[model samples]
Target: MSFAKAQDLLRLALMASTRHFGVSLEDIRAEFSVSHRTAQRMTDALELTFANVTKQTGSDRRSYWKVDDPTIAQLQPHQETAVEALEIASRRAKEEGRLRHAQALEDTRNGLMLRLSARDAKRAETDAEAVLEALGQVTRPGPRVPLNQKIADAVTEGLRGPFRLEIIYSGRSDQARTIEPYGLLLGPRSYLIAKQPDRGAELLNFRMDRIQSAKCLDEWFIPENGFSIENYAAQAFGAYHDPDQLKEVVWRFKPEAAERASEFRFHPKQTLQYQADGSLIVRFTAAGWLEMSWFLYEWGDAVEVIDPPELRDFVQGYQRADFPSLP
Candidate 1:
């Protein structure tokens, strides 16, 4: 009835036309943040407006709505901003050593270009490249460990299959191992989160650089029940994780640095308490004290360790060059 409603109906039509399996009532409700009744009304509106609209039942026994033609989903010639954004993201991904992600982004950009006429596609690409070149290279501070492209590709294929990975690791010993990949952790040093069935189901981090080679096995595996990469990663402040060394960490930031410190997300589960005197206290439960200490050094005298006497002792000892024994 309203302009906004008209726009929403058109947007819904575009989405329904573009998806291969069509969309369900649940999908409509979630996308539009509408109730079941509203979603049904919107679906009815789409059927009335689009001649190609059809309904089909899914394997789950739920009905799905699809449009036979995707004319409504076609991109506008003036909207080259989308292409430019994808180009920028691809370069950023490459700079971050995420070769797979960069390739995917580039592929998507080329696909979008193919949707246009040959001449228009060439013009769009030339313009996008010009914009990218003018922006110059982005230099990211900190060390970035280069990932082995072949090993990275193998890890990706293994995870997609939920298959086992046979890898040659150059850790303390150069040994061949078969592991189940859970996910990957990308940082200054990238790692593959996997578990060796022979060793047990406990997930461990294996440095990507140390993986001399990887191969995806034909065997499939059921992912661990209730296993979340985010939750596992949250257990540690950085890519490093040591379950046995887990502890509640506390840090107090001086007023001079409190504002800047509050802007940082030191940990996923970290909490902040603003002191009456303007100091800030950050607290979180995590392992990897060594990684945490590395970040603390950046704050210099602006921060102090409030608990975990061992961590305080370690930091203090490291600063004084005594290298105290850590528990």
Candidate 2:
């Protein structure tokens, strides 16, 4: 191994031994694949000086060195300092180009001193200030909803079963509606999948973002057999739609745009077929008209709806009304 690589390994060994096994020279050398002399040299090189080395005699009359340092006992240089220093340096490097040069200097000094270099210390202080500034900008100067804790309690209630919840849900129309929550759907975003008792059999999905408040009700509900949150959420494109209305909607992508569509499977049910003119045929079902509208809007002129005349008409109407001048 190179000298630098060997030094790194020796440093790691010393750190591990000091932190975990109370800094036994024999343990450091054996674990790090280094000579006793090399291990002794490493201990001497460390910034934190080891004091009171006691010689212990074992059953076989072998001698061992025991390190006694209260500082070593309290401060774990590797775990507490080194990793944090590297992270701070990396963040500063990304945000401020000039800071990277300073961070590099600090990292070198940290390797030698076993503490954050002066530059790294400054970077850390700057990071703290930046964090506080960002927090000040984003944080409202009023009481905020404890969303994470509320979600955790809701999840616990759902898992334990026999639970019903009342949530002040905001709809896509930005109308607030009160409903009894059936269960929660943990999606790319979290959702409360609740049945609108007033609406009758209409399963409404309330985005956690749009939910103003939720309260557990006195009544309990039993989830139906074969009902799964993952399966249900995966069936639709976005959180708002349902998957029960699966109808094969086909679209033809122009040759230039074909590769883009084929690059990633946009939907689990998506199927790609090459057309005669080198174009691509992408087929996937929509749970409702909402997802269909989104797909058509996103693909634009690069895609043409081939099947489901209603979808073609929907796109045509949008084109005529929205972009009448465009071909």
Candidate 3:
């Protein structure tokens, strides 16, 4: 096996040891299908770096290697669960023809799963296989690209300095344009927030999926003062957010829906008031009409747009047009 693959197996063994036997080297090596000598070498490598490895007396009266890092031990359960979820999601993405994204997610899931117990690893693989089988039947085909890492790196670069980017962007009308990038933003979806030379004064939001190609430019631009990504995202929904687009919206939910809505706060701007009928009146500011539409649609017939005639009209239009009609 490749050294990286072997190392990954070793790490999973180590993690499992911590959870089940307080880091027994013998147990770990056996789990990885490795010899005692190789397992000793692996433990030695970890000891050199973490300084947490030591010999301990087990119930069998044998001395075994152990890792005493409480923090790492605490994360074992969560790490295993997250790895399994990622594996399931990755397989689903693949069956849907999201080849690039699936590969990337699969790689990440494997890497993370290698830090979990053998039992968890086996469970994840089984679940992933099952999910893929189900996905094969129902997944809708779509144009998918592995854009998460690219967007994350680009955003990091932008946040570090005023990094410039050269991007081939596909617009709303499906027209492609080359543009110089400014800042990147994490909206409901990741967006390349930049100004196009042709579209002066308008900071355009380009969906990462629509970006055909991107290159970091030699030139850079300084970010304007008082502009924070967190603040920007808090005020907007999706990728079409602008500082000037904020507007208050009110909605009423049926009693059953109101009880559900009360359990979670949808937005920082959201305000909920209890009605006499045990329903809820929710008020929040939206960056655009698109966000309001999506919020309403998610609730089905449980919600009603109370104020803003435009929003109510828009919701009504979608209800009448989008749903199938019975003859």
Candidate 4:
């Protein structure tokens, strides 16, 4: 067999061992960019080679093969890139104030390294250091709340179960409330996107830091039909979701800052129109004017809010001593 074919087989074997749901023939075909016949042959090869390879049918009635024995998939010398990526990610998470998450990543990296030879482990360390130095992180200085591991785990359970959470929130009110968890919006400051059934079907952002405790109830919830956390999060500038204030926002950048502004992914659905005068007009429909205002202040005189007079007023109002709150 060719060296490349051997490597592919090894990689496929490793993947099969790690994935709980196992791998499908379609998965093999997609992973290696092979034809259906080739994918079938690969599976046959795995069955012939690995004694512990077993096939199981899922709820969808589709059969997939899983390598029950994990030792069959050993770490190889060529997997330095994985180690480097993990190190970089760990450092970034630590810098971002996710200490617990960073430690978990570091632990995983260390465990993976231990599986390799001492020489390979040393080489991986050197390569990771080089990669980190070459690609340094530049983070915005802000309040990055470190999540409580217990609360985070509870929230995860609730989200995965589609279960209601009884949380002790310290934001605005010092009381416990039961909410149907939609999902979590992770960032410098994370939030739990959920709905208070007593209040209405409207979604609310509960700051993660303010959640003193979270208890996943035994009961499960019926998620709203056609509800997607990503789609909901995209409708806002940031975590603060206010459906009432949703508007078509427009901003114009001066000729000098146009190039800089063009490089920014301010919003997923944003569009840019470059003018003859070299100015750039950015347009996106979103909510969370407060968060948007915070970003706009950094641009100073280089940017102008052309649409949504309310937002323009809100931005200008900040300059006044008697500035009123957002409407």
Q: Identify the leading candidate in terms of TM-score.
A: 1
State which candidate, 1 or 3, has the greater lDDT. Answer: 1
In terms of lDDT, model 3 sits at: 0.64
> lDDT values of the candidates?
0.86, 0.58, 0.64, 0.85
TM-score preference between candidates 1 and 2, better one: 1
RMSD (Cα, Å) of candidate 3? 12.2
Deviation of model 2 at 267, angstroms: 0.9
Expressed as tens digits, the lDDT of each residue in 229-256 for candidate 1 is 9888888988878877688999998887
Worst ten in a row by lDDT for model 3: 318-327
Task: Give the per-residue lDDT of model 2 (tens digit) for 157-241.
Answer: 6445656665655555445444555556543356667676668766667666566656666677655666766666656665557
Model 1: lDDT equals 0.86
Task: Write the residue-wise lDDT of candidate 3 on 204-246 in tens digits.
Answer: 7777767766666666775566765566666765456755557
Per-prediction TM-score to the true structure, in the order listed: 0.76, 0.46, 0.52, 0.73
Where model 3 places Cα greater than 4 Å from the true spot, the runs are: 1-82, 89-162, 170-190, 196-202, 209-212, 242-245, 260-268, 294-302, 313-327
Model 1 clash pairs? none
**lDDT leaderboard ranking:** 1, 4, 3, 2
What clash count goes with each model?
0, 0, 0, 0
